[model samples]
Target: MPDKYEAELPDEVHELLAAADKDREIRLTRAATAENLKFLELVRSKVKDVPLFWAVTLLSHPELGQAASSTSDKEVFKYLTDVELVQDAHDPREYEIVFHFKENPYFTNTELRKKYSLPNGTKPAPADGTITDEMRAFEAIDLEPSSMTIEWKADNDLIAKHPRKLNSEDDEIIDGDIGSFFHFFTEKSDIMSLGGTIIDVLAEPLEFFANDPSGFDSDFDEEDEEDEGSIDLGDDDDEDEPQRKKQKKERCCHP
Candidate 1:
C-alpha cells in the first residue's frame, strides 16, 4: 500500500529524521510514524465492522431498519468479517463500504408488469413509474433502486470520528476516486444499506470514469469511420449499375 501520508509529508521530513540519530527530533519522528501506522492498522481491522446481512436485509425491506436499530457496532463488524466482506482502506481500521444492486435477466417484462402494477400495453411508462422487467428482477434479487447520490462527506466524517492517534486535522482526506470505483462495483451486488455510504465514497472515481468522454472518444471515432465506410459501399453499388446494364445489352446482342 502506498504510504497514506507520503503525499502530505514534506520530503525534508524524512531527511530530518535520518540526520538526527541522537536528537529529540528523531525520537519525535519515530514516535509519529509508529502512531500513524498503529492508527492505520486499527482502521483496517474495522473494515469488516459492518454487517453485510443486516445491510442487505434493511435494503430489501427498508421496514427492517427498525429491527436493526439495536444492532451494535461490534456485531455489525463481526457479520461483515464473517462473510469476508471487508472494505479496502488506507488504514487497517478504516474500511470503505460498498453496497451493490444488480439487474436480474431471468425475469421477463410481463412478469414485472404483473408484479409491480405496471400500466398494461406499455407505451413506455412515465419516468417516475418506469420499472423495466430487468429492474424488477434486480429488486427480487435484493437490489434496490437508490436515488441517493454516493455521499462522501458521511464516510469522511465517520473516519474522523473514530478514535485514532492521528489528529483529526491530520487524517488523510480519503480520495473520492477510490470510493467511487468501489461503489460502482458494489452497486452491482445484492447488498444495500446505510453502510453503502462508505462504498459510495469509494466508487466516486468509477462513476466519473464511466461518464468521462475521454475514455469513449476513440471508440466513437471508430464507429463513425465504419458508418462512413458503409455509406461508401452504397455509392459503389450506384456506380456499378450503368456497367451492369452495358454488360446485359452486349450479352443480349450476341445471343
Candidate 2:
C-alpha cells in the first residue's frame, strides 16, 4: 500500500511537500527560540532573589541530581549562581552551556562552559545513504560528546576526593566515584542520552523551582510564612529577621 501511494505521487509533489514541511519547521524553531530567550532573561533577573535557586532545581530532579549524590557535589553546587545556554552566532545547530559560579572554596574560575556541535555541522547519512530534509534540521541530530576542564582549588578537586577502584592486572583505575556532579564539568556527558530535558529545564526553570520540596526556606520564621508577600529573598524590609524562602516542590525531568 505504501509503495502504491509513492508511485501515485509525482516526484515534484514530494519535493513541494518536503519544502513546505522544512519551511514550517524553520518557522516553529524561530518562534520557540525567541520565546526561550525571553524566558531565560526573566530567569536571570529573578533567580538571584531566590538563593540556591539553581541548586535546588537540580537536586529536586531525581535524574539530574544523580551525579551530585555525594556531599561534596552538593556543597560545590551551592555556589552555582547561574546556568546559561549560548547559541553560536554563526551556526544555529551549535551552542554552549555556561555555568556561572560565585566566589567559593571549590574553584577559582567564575564560569565553566561546554560547547556542543555536530561533526562538520551536519548529520551523517543513514545506513541506506538517504538524508531527509527533516534530518537536516538542527533538532534532528545528537550533539557530539564534549568535555571541559575545571580549575579546581588545591585539595578541592571533588572528582578526585572520591576513591576509585583499580584493575588488578595492569593496575589501571577503573571507572568509579565519577558520579560527582563536578564530573559534569570534567567529563563528557552523553548529551544524546540527556535529550531535551536539560534544555527544557533551562528554558522553564521556574516550573522546576516550584517543584523543589527541600528548598532553602528552613531559615524563615513561621510568622513570615503566614504573609506570602513577606517571603521575598530580595526584600530588605526586615533587616534583623531572616528572609522568608520561596516555596519549592519535587519534580523530575529525566531524559
Candidate 3:
C-alpha cells in the first residue's frame, strides 16, 4: 500500500465537494420561487394597458414608490413578456428591453439605462434606431378639434329683454321658446312683467308643449320668423312698433 492516507483523504474531499456543487446549482436554477411569480403576475396585470414608457418607468426604477406600490413582481414579468419588452439573448437570465422616443428615437445603451433608471445589475445593449419624418410631423400637430357644440337653452325673459341683441352673458343659448302670455301666466306665475314672466315660464319643463309634435311644429314654424326678425316682446314699445307692424303685415299678406 503506497500512501493509503493520502489516497483516502483526496477521494473523500473531492466527492464531498462535487455533491455540494451539484446542490448549489440546483438551488440557483430554482431561484425564482412561487412568491416571485405571484409578485410578477400582479405587476404585469396592473401595467399591461399602461404606455410602454410608463411601464418601463415603474418596473426599472424601484425608487418610484408610486409605481412599485401598485404592482407585484409577477405582474411586472408578465407585462414585460406580453409587451415583448425583453428581447432574446444568449444568456436566458438576461433581457434586452428597448424604449423609443419618436422624435429622437435613436438612443445609446448608456443613455437608455440612465434615462429609464434600469436596475444596477441590468446590462442594456442598443440595436438600431430611426426617426421617420411622418412621426416627427404627427408629434408636431395638435390633434384636438377646434370647436364643439353644446345643447343649451336661454331664459325666455332674457331672450325677451334683449330681443334685438344676442344674450351677451349666455352666448350659448341654443333654444328659446316659451308659450303665449296666458299660458305663461296660468302655468308659470302671476308676474305681470313680460320679461320676468317669460323667464319664469321658460324655466319650467316644456313637456306639455313638446308632447304634441304637430302643435309644436306648427308653433315653431309660426314663431321661427319672429325669432329670425329679432322681435322681443319686452323691448321698448317705441322701438318694437315698426318690427311688430312689419311682422303683422307679413303674417296677413303671407298667410
Candidate 4:
C-alpha cells in the first residue's frame, strides 16, 4: 500500500493507517459458542468501507479461526512458506515460530497445542492450564486478539512435548501467513529492527511443511491470469450486504 497507493490516497487515509498500525487487540468479537462464527463474520464485513489498515482488531474469519482451533491435523493452507521454527524461550524445549524475516515474528509455539499431556499423562484443569493449539487456539486467538501477543514466555518440554502434538492446521496457516506477510514487506525497499536470536530454536533445519514441495501447481499462473478478470468483489452480494441476512456485520495491529 505504501508503495503503490500511498501517493494517490488522501492524507486522511495515511493518518488512519498510522493510527491503526499502532492500535492493538487481544481478541475478536467473542460471542457464545453458537454465535462465534456469526460474530466473526460480523466484524469482517463491518470494516468493508474502512481501509484494510484500519481493520485493527479482527484476527481471523470465523471459518479460519474455528477451523484453526480444532485439534485435528487438518490442512490449514494449500502450501507452506519459508520460516525459522524455534523453541519458546521460557520453554526452550517446546516450540516457537519466528518468521525468517528480521522484523516479522509469527505466533509462538505454546500457543498451538490444544490440550497438552502432563508428565503423568493427564489433561490439566482449565484453571491449571491454558487453551492452546487446534480448536482451542482459534477460540483464544481469533476470539480474543486483544488479549494475545505474538511473543510468549513458553512452556518447556517438561511442560509438554509441543512438537509431538503436530496438528498441521496451525502449521499450514502459520506457514502460509509467513509467506504472504513477507511477500508484502519484501515488495517494499526496507524496514528496521533485527531479531535473529530465534536461530537457537532447534539448530536443525526449519520445519518442512510444503504439501507441494515440487511446486507442481506452479503452472497454474495461466489459470490465475485467466480467472483474474472473471472475478469481481460484487460476486458475493450476501457477504457484502449484511442486511440481506439477519446476520451481521472485524486485527491485532503493528508497524
- Local accuracy by lDDT, each model: 0.26, 0.57, 0.25, 0.22
Segments in model 1 whose C-alpha atoms lie over 4 Å from true places: 1-22, 51-255
lDDT of 2: 0.57
Weakest 10 consecutive residues of candidate 3 by summed lDDT:
246-255
Error of 1 at 229 (Å): 54
Ranking by lDDT: 2, 1, 3, 4
C-alpha displacement of 209 in model 2, angstroms? 0.1
Can you write out model 3's per-residue Cα lDDT over 96-159, one digit (the tens) per residue? 2222222211111111210112234334332332322222222101211111121112332321
Q: Could you tell which candidate, 1 or 3, scores higher by lDDT? A: 1
Clashes (N, CA, C under 3 Å) per candidate: 23, 5, 14, 23
Give candidate 4 regions above 4 Å deviation. 1-81, 88-92, 100-255
Model 2 C-alpha lDDT per residue in residues 1-255, reported as the tens digit of each score? 465543467899998887777756555654676687777878788767556777766555544555455556666667789888885322345567777899999889899777666766465434453435635454634665567888889997766775445456653447643344555555565422332445667766766555534433333232233312111122223332222223344344321
Q: Is candidate 1 or candidate 4 better by lDDT?
A: 1
Model 3 vs. true fold: TM: 0.20
Q: Lowest lDDT 10-mer window, candidate 1?
A: 246-255
Write the residue-wise lDDT of candidate 1 on 1-255 in tens digits.
765654455789976654443344324433543554455345335534432322332212211222122223112221222111232212121222222322222111111100111123433323453333433222122322222232323233221222223224543324311121122222323122333333332222222212312111122211242211110111212321211001111000000
Name the candidate, 1 or 2, with the larger TM-score value. 2
